[model samples]
Each structure stands twice: as structure tokens, then as C-alpha cells.
Target: MKRGRLALGIIGALALGLGGSVVALRAGAGETDRAELEKRWADAPSRFVTVDGVRMHVREEGPANGPVVVLLHGSIVNLHEWDDVVPLLADKYRVVRFDWSPYGLTGPDPSGFYSTPRSAQLMDGLMKALGHDKFAMVATSNGANVGLEFNRAYPGHVTAMAFSMLPLERPSQTRKVDWRLKWMLEAHKAVLPNWRHREFWRLMLEDTTPPEFTPTDRMVDQITEMNNLPGALDRQAQYIQANVRAFQSSDVGAVAEAVRVPVLLQWCSFDDVISQSADASVKRFTNTKVDVINYPDLGHFPMWEKPEKFTRDLRNWLDRQPPAPAG
Candidate 1:
């Protein structure tokens, strides 16, 4: 066979093998109890609050009157995504984190709304309820999207924001999701619920990382355990689908154009997705006070993979900003 045909054959074989792996590992896979999962993740200031009909898990730290710093995590992760970085800020800033809809201990959305506007409103309410008026935010991936919306809706309330990444340009005119890729994700929504816990962790950690970073077995085990929590996948699937529509709407990118506060854009050296966006953000925010920090050796989750470096860089930026408003 020719080289092109030979490569095609190998690709097909790998795809088939991956499918087989999912099915084989799914056998006897059982869901975990919600109570057990919640018990494991929620601790020390982590508790549930009914925010606009959604019961979200929130954790706050530092003095009740300190400058507020809200940590917003990425997709498929929870408030605890800040576990490595929160301690660094908690001593001085009033650090707050919360489990968003269909992720972490928060569970599904009671309102069935997963768009940026809905999420931004919910976050605003959460801050007000906590007695924080002006605050700073550390937002990653999906959370960064919501953070942009929050800043747009309530510009005065947001003093500064550190974005893991963002795109300043408008989205492509082409169809957002290819039919084949969309079909695969939609099909796996069911398979994911039944798929082996380890497989879920592997797929999530599969990309968006530097080539040499090796996730420990312990890290994989912990993520797998959280993913395998009962009812988690079901809620995950629901939010995933809704979020797909939200992406097409480009609400996050649209909101970015209006953000007037100081922003720290953190970029991953090897990340193919966010670097371009980071550059575009510079152009879009020409009139605003914006700074960039390139993580030369890091990946998507810098705070998780390189907490010391991430927190140090973040502190350098945070310390330069104006003091937080008196509580």
C-alpha cells in the first residue's frame, strides 16, 4: 500500500482501539454516591449556598474584611481547582471559590441555564451575598469566560482580573463545530457516564499540557474518583451541551471588548489555543491597562502544575494594583 493509505489504516486502527478501551473498561463500572463525593471535596469553609435556585458549593478564606479574590476554575473542574494557589492568597486577600453548575460538589443547575449571562449574574449575586462589593478575580478557561461577562455587567465591582486566556477577536465565520466532531462528543455523552473512571481522567488530562509533564498516578486517581461520583456525569452532560451553544454565541469574546478594568493575561508557552487569543486581547484592550505573563514552561493549568511559579507571578501583579476597598 502507498504511504498515505498506510497512514490512514493506522489512524483507523487507533480509533477502533480507543473505542474498545472505553467499552472494555466500562464493564461493572458503578456510580458513586453524591453524599460520599460531597463529603470528600467539601471542607473548611466549603459549603453549599442556594444562588438563584442553584445550590453551589462555595469556600471563602482570610479575614472577613479583607480584599476579596474570587477564583474561577475551568471546565470539568470545580472550585477546588484553586487548591494549590488559594493558600498563597488567603493570608492577605479574602479568597473565595465556588463549584459551578454541573461541576464539583455543586451538581446540576436548577434553572437549566448555563450561558454566560446566567453564570455572570449568579456570580454577582454570590459576591453581594458574601458582602463583597469591589473585588479581584482569578479565572481559568471556562471560568475566565464568565469572568469577562461579570466584568462587563458590573464593571465597577471588578477592580482587576487575571485571565488564564482569552480571545479578543471575533470567532470564525465558518461553522463552529464540525459535524463529525460534534457527533462524537454527543455520542460519548452517554458513554462517558458509563466509561471507566480512569479513562475520564486520561481524556481530560490528555491535552493542553506541555509534552514533558507527567501526571502522577495519584493525580489521575483523584480526578477519576471525583468524576466517578454518582449523578456527576449526568449533570456534566447536561451542562456540556448547553455550554456548546454558549460557545457558538461568542458571548465571552463579545464581553471582552467592553472590559475596562486592568487585566493580567497569562499564556501557556505550548498551548495552541490561547496564545493567539492573548495577542488579540492586547490589541482589543489598547486603551485599558493590560499586562501579559507568558508561562514559558507551563501548560493550561499553571496553578495546578506549577503552583509556586503561578502564585509568585500572580502576587507580583496583584501587589501592584490599588488597595482593595475597605470591607
Candidate 2:
């Protein structure tokens, strides 16, 4: 047999084995109750607000009268990603962070609707519930996409936006995959709802960060427990698919050009996943005052990896901006 054929045979065997294992694991998996998760994750300053019928888990810090700043975490992660930066911003700004459904203690949305547009709507509703009319936004990864969508839908509501690891183009569109192997991806998504292995979460974290940045055991536990929540896996899969559809159907250039507020682009040098979009993102923000800063050593989650530096840089940039009228 040809070497290529042999390699293909091995790949086929591995795929079959993995798929079978996933199905078996899924059969035995059970969902954890939201009430139980709340006990473990929710604490001081944590509150739930009904936004568009979905209960949102949110935290507010700093002075109530201070300038408002909202923090948006990336996909598959909760608001805790900014645990280190919240206090720093809270010193002068009324910093707010929240967990989107299916990702944090917020649990899953009953509607199962997940997309950037929907997230933007939820955000607007959440802000109104909190009595915030306008605010600055610090968003990462998919959250940045939500921020952009929010700004486009409600112009002048966002005074400024700072984005890191912004994916101007969705990965599915950029990384072309063979149609023959697509089912493997689908099977993985199907299996996620039943998956509850901490090692798997640990591996994912390690793969995204530098070798030196070992994800703590607590981090692994948190992620595992969150994903294992009842209905979270299914909702997360739907969210991923919805996001891809939104990106595919919408014009990214139009969205970026629509942004009129001051912008900050914190591009990471080592995040091979989305770094390619960095230069393109800056150029797309032709209508706004965009400040580009490259972190030569950072990976995907720069804020999580170096909160102090991230917060300091953000503060300095924000201080330089002339105060704009609140919405």
C-alpha cells in the first residue's frame, strides 16, 4: 500500500474510535442543576437581572457615580477572565462584567438563541436594567464582535471600545476544511454536552497559552463545571453555529466602518488563531480613531494572561480621550 493510503487509514481508525467513545460517554452524561452551580459560583456583588426574559448574572464594582465601563469576555469563558482587571478599573470607573448564558453561572437561555446580534440585544437590555445609558466597552474575542454589533445597532451608545484578539473573519471561513472531515467536527459538538472531563479543559487552556503559563487546577475545574451544566453544552454548540452564520451573512467591513467612537485594537503577536486579522481589523476601522498596539509576546487572552499591564494600558488610553457626552 502507498504511504499516503496508510496514513489515511490510521486517521480513519482514530476518528471512528473517538466518535464511538464520545457517543458512549454522552449516553451516560447528566446535566447539573442551575441552583447547585449558583451555590458554588455566585457570591458577593453578584446579582441576577431578567434581561429579555433570560436571567443574566452580573457584577458591578467601583463608585456608582463614576464613568461606566463594561467588560466582555470571550467564548467558552465567563466574566472571571477579568478578575484581575475589574478592581483596577473600578477605582475610577463603574466597572461591570457579566456571564453570558451557557458559559457561566448564568446557565442557559430558554430560547436557545445565540448570536452576536442577540448578545447585543441582551447587553442593551442589561444596561437599561442597570440604569446605564452609555459606557465604554472592553471586549475580547467573540465578545468584541458583540461589542461591534452593539455599536452598529445603537450608534453613539458606546463611547469607546477596546478589543483584543478580534476576529474580523470567522475561523470556519478562513480555515477551509475538507467536506469529508466535517462530520467529525459535528460529532465533537454533539458530544460536548456529555463531556465533563477536567483534563480536557486543562488541555484546551494549555494549548491556547504559552508553555510557561500553566492553567491552575481551579481554572480547569471552573471551566469543566461550567460546561457540564445542564443544557449548556447544547446551547454552546448552537451559539458557535449561530456565530458562524452571522459572520458569514454579515459584512464585517461595513460593521467596522460604521463604528464612530474612539477605538483601541490590542493585537497579540502569538495568537496564531486570530492574529492574522489584526492588521485587517485596524484598516477596517476607517471611520473611527483607532489606536493599534501590538503585544509581541502575548497569546489569545492577553487580559487574562497579564491583567495589570492590560488594565494599565487601557486606563492610559482612556484617560487621553476627551470626555464625550453620555447617552
- List pairs with backbone clashes in candidate 2: none
Candidate 1 lDDT: 0.72
Q: Write the per-residue lDDT of candidate 2 for residues 1-327, one digit (tens) a residue.
A: 699999999999999998787666676554556787777777778889988688899999988888888899988788888888888777778888998655787745667688778888888888888988878888988888888888888777788889887877775344433443344445455555455566566766765666677777767777777877766766777888887776678765468888888899887776766734666778888887789888877777787678788788989988777643332
Write candidate 1's Cα lDDT for 222-294 as tens digits: 5666666665666666655666666666544556667777889887765554535566667766447889988
| Model 2 regions lying over 4 Å from their true place | 1-30, 172-193, 323-327
Q: Quote the positional error of residue 89 for candidate 1 in Å.
A: 1.4
In angstroms, give how far residue 184 of model 2 lies from its true place: 11
Work out candidate 1's RMSD over C-alphas.
6.8
Model 2: residue 203 alpha-carbon error in angstroms:
1.3
Global fold similarity of model 2 (TM-score): 0.84
Q: Which consecutive 10 residues in model 2 have the weakest lDDT in total?
A: 172-181
